[model samples]
Target: MADGQDLMERIGRLRPAVRAAGQPLHRPLLLLWAIAQAVHGRPRQQPWSVVKHELAPLLTQFDGAQRGERDVVYPFWALQRDGLWEVADSAELPLTSGGRRPTFAILEQVNPLAGLPEADYNRLIDDSTVAADALSTLLVRFFGANSGSVVEALRLREFVRGPIGASLLPLVGEQYADRKKIAEAYGGNGVMGITPLADGILAVYSDDKGPYPDHHIPETGWIAYTGDGLSGDQTLTVGNKSMQEYQKQEKALRYWHKPYNGSWTFETWAVVIQCRRRWGRGEDKKQRREYVWVLAPVPSPLRETWPSDVVEALAQDDKSVHDDSVDVIPAEVVAGQESRKLSAQERYQQLSDAARRTDGNRTNRSKPTLVERYMRSAAAREAVIIRSEGRCENPACGGHPLERTDSGQPLLEVDHVNGLARTGQDTPEFMIALCPNCHALKTRGAGRGELQKSLVPVARKLHRAMQRGERRKARPDGT
Candidate 1:
C-alpha cells in the first residue's frame, strides 16, 4: 500500500488525461464534496444518493457540461486505483465509460459504503490540517486548467500557500454556506413529466447512445421552459427553435448551437461551456467526440422556471447566484477622512465581516449609496432599451428576445458593449441592447469576438447620436 506521503503526492499529480477537450473535474469535485461532508460531521463515505444530490450540480458548475452526470460515479469507484479513495460496492464493477450504474431506488438519507482506508480516513476527520493539505493538493492539481496557476489565484488564503489548518481552507468556511442550499435545490425531486432546463439554456448535446430518457448525464434533457416547469405541449414557446424543429434539422445536435452567423440560435450557460461548440469530423479517428447533454436546470433556467422565492433565497448570498446577469449589491467602501491602519487580526475580522454581509443595502455608514448604483444600472438599461427601439442592435440578426415579456415590452436585455466583466462601465454609452440570440452570438468564439469588435464602431456612433440629441434638448445652454 502507498504511504500517506506517496498518496498525497499522487493526488496532487492527477490530471485530465481522460478526454482531449475537457479536463476531467470528477475526482477533485468528489474530494471537495466529500471533505465538506466530513468537515460538517457527515461521514467521509457519503451515500450514493447524497453524493449524487450534492456533487452533480457542483460537477456541472466546475466541470464543463462535456462530461455526463455518470462521470461523478467514476471518481467514487475508480479512485481506488489512485489510493486516495475507495468504494465499497456489493457487485463487480461495470465497464461503461462514465462509472458504475446506479439503481433508481435511492433513499437520500442513507449513507453508502465508501472512503479512504480506516487510518487515512480517521486522520482526515481527526486532524483538520491533513484535510486542508489534501484539499489544497486537489484544488491546485485540478484547477490548473484555469487561467492562472491555482497557487497564484488562491494565494490570499494561507492553505493556498501551504495548509495552515482547516481555518485557512477557502472552500470550508461560510463563503460556501450557500453550497448546501444549491445542493439541496438540485437534490430535491426535480420537476417531473417534462424536460427540466429552460428552452434557451443550451447544453452540450449527448451522443444519443443511451436508452430512452436515461442519458448518462444527470438532470440532462432539454425541457422547453413553457411555464411552471411543464412542457407547453412540448412546444417551442421559449425561443425561436422548437424541439420538433431541432429534431428535424439534419445538423447533428452538436452543431445545433446559438450564434455562429446562423439564421437561428440557442443560448446556454457554461463556465467555459460558452455557447455550445459541436464536434466535427476532421479526417481519421472519427473527427470529434460529443458530450452527453445533462437535464438539470442551470442557473438561468432555475431563475426562470423555479419558484421566484427559491431563486431569491438562493441568490441572496453574493457568491451563491452563479448567473452573470444576477445583480449583486457590493458594499460601498466609505473612505474615512483619515484611515487608521488595521492590525492583522482586525484585517482578517474585517474581511470576514464583509464576506458575510452580502445582502442588499445594509444600513451602515453609507446606507443610501446602493440606490445610486441601482439607479445607474436601471437608467443604463432603460437608455439601452430605448436606443435599440425594441429591435436588436445587431443589424445582421434582428431577432426579438424570443417572445415579449409580460410587461408588454420587447424582450431585450442590456449587455455591456465592451464586455461587462472586463472593462466596460454599466452606462448607456457602454451598454448595448440585444435580443437573447444576438447576445449569445456576441459572447462566444473568436469569430464572434471579431464581430463584437466591429460593433464597437456602431455602438460609438449610437452614443454620439444620442449625445447630439440630448444637446438639442438642452439647446438654451448648448454652447
Candidate 2:
C-alpha cells in the first residue's frame, strides 16, 4: 500500500503515457470510477466484466477529449504503476512476448479483480473529509466545470461544494470572434481544410456555402462532411489522411463552421466513425470519387444532448481500434508487399493467421524501435455481410432493415461479437452483420448484455456453416 499523501499526489498528476496523445482522461476517469464504487461501500476490488460494462460508458461520457475508442484496459492495468491501485492474481496474468501489458482480451480471460489498494480503500472509507477532498481534486483538476451530472451520477454530490463552475473547453453554440482566434488558441492552420494541431488534435473547417457543404443530420447529433480535395479524385492523402490519423489515434476533431457572411462559430467535437466513397462533381466540375465521412458527436462541455443510438455508435466504432499486442497487417502494408491476386477468403485466412502469431512481439535487434499498428480487414467485413444472408443477425430484428446505401449495398453494420479489443480478431467468427437498428440495440439498449452473449454463438455457428460450404442465401435480385 502507498502512503496516503503520495497516493493523492499521484492521482493529482495523473496523465497519459504518451504526452503528445493529448491530455487523456482514461486514468483519471478510471480512478474516479473506483472511488465512486468505494464510496458506495462496494468491494475494494471488482471483476473486469463489471468494470468493462460500467466503467467504459463512464469513460466515454466524461473523457470527451477523444472522439473514438476509450482505452479502458490501459487505465485499469496502468493504475497499478501509480501505486494507488492493485489487481488480484496480477502475477498470474499473461503478457505478450515482450512482457508488456496484455490486450483487453487477455485480461478478460484472466478475469482478475482490481480496485483501490486495501489501505487506500480503507482510508477513503474511514475518513469522510479525505474522501471529499479527493473527489474535489478529481472534479476540479481533471474535469473542471464540464463535470456535467458527473457528481450526481457518481453519487459524490455530498462532497461537492455548490455546483461545479464553467467548462474549460470551448462551449457549443457559442460564437467565436474569427478563424484567427480559434487557430491562435488551438494551434492549427487557419486557412486549410484540415489542420493537424499539436498533441494529436485535429481542426476541420466547414463552410455552409462552400463547394463542399457539410450537412447536419436533423436531431441526430451527427454531421456529414465530404472528404478534403476539391479538385479531381480525392485520394486518401494530405488533409484527408490527417482525418484518418485522428480516427486512428482516437482523438476528437475540433470542428468550426462558417455560415455565409457569418462569424466563424466553434461547432462540436466529433469522431470520424464511417466513411464511404461516392461519385460527385468537384470544384473543377469534373465527376470523380469523393469520400463522405460520418462524424458522430461525443458528449462534451461543448454539447449538451446526445442521441442514444449515436452514443451506442461511438462506443461500438471506438472499439474497432485496439492497441493490443496482436499483429494485424494493414491493407496498405499488404498491398505494398504483395503482387498476387488473393481472394477475400484467402486474405481473411492470411490476416487471421498473422493476428494469431506472436512474431510482432519478437525482438528486432536491428529495428528495435519499430511500431506496429492494427488495421481491420476489409475481407472480414465482406465475409460477415455475405454470410448474414441479407438479414440482421440479432434474431429479433427479423431481417436486415429495408434500406440500401447510395452504392446499393445493404445498409448493414458489421459488428464484433466480443469487441475487437477483447478478441483482437477481425475474422467472421468473431463478428456479425446487423441492421442499424439492431446494432444500436446491441450496443446501448436494455438487455444489451444478453444480446451480446447470444450473438457470440450466432457468429461462431454462422462461420462454421460457411466453412462447411453452405450455399449463401441470395438477395431478392438473385444475382
Question: Which one wins on TM-score?
Answer: 2
Give the best candidate by lDDT: 2
Candidate 1, superposed: residue stretches over 4 Å from native: 1-4, 66-69, 90-112, 144-479
Task: List runs of model 2 lying over 4 Å from the truth.
Answer: 1-166, 196-200, 218-221, 245-251, 299-306, 315-479
Candidates in order have lDDT scores of: 0.41, 0.64
Question: What is the C-alpha lDDT profile of model 2 across 386-431, one tens digit per residue?
Answer: 5665567665674446567654557899989877656655567888
Write down the RMSD of candidate 2 (Cα, Å): 21.0
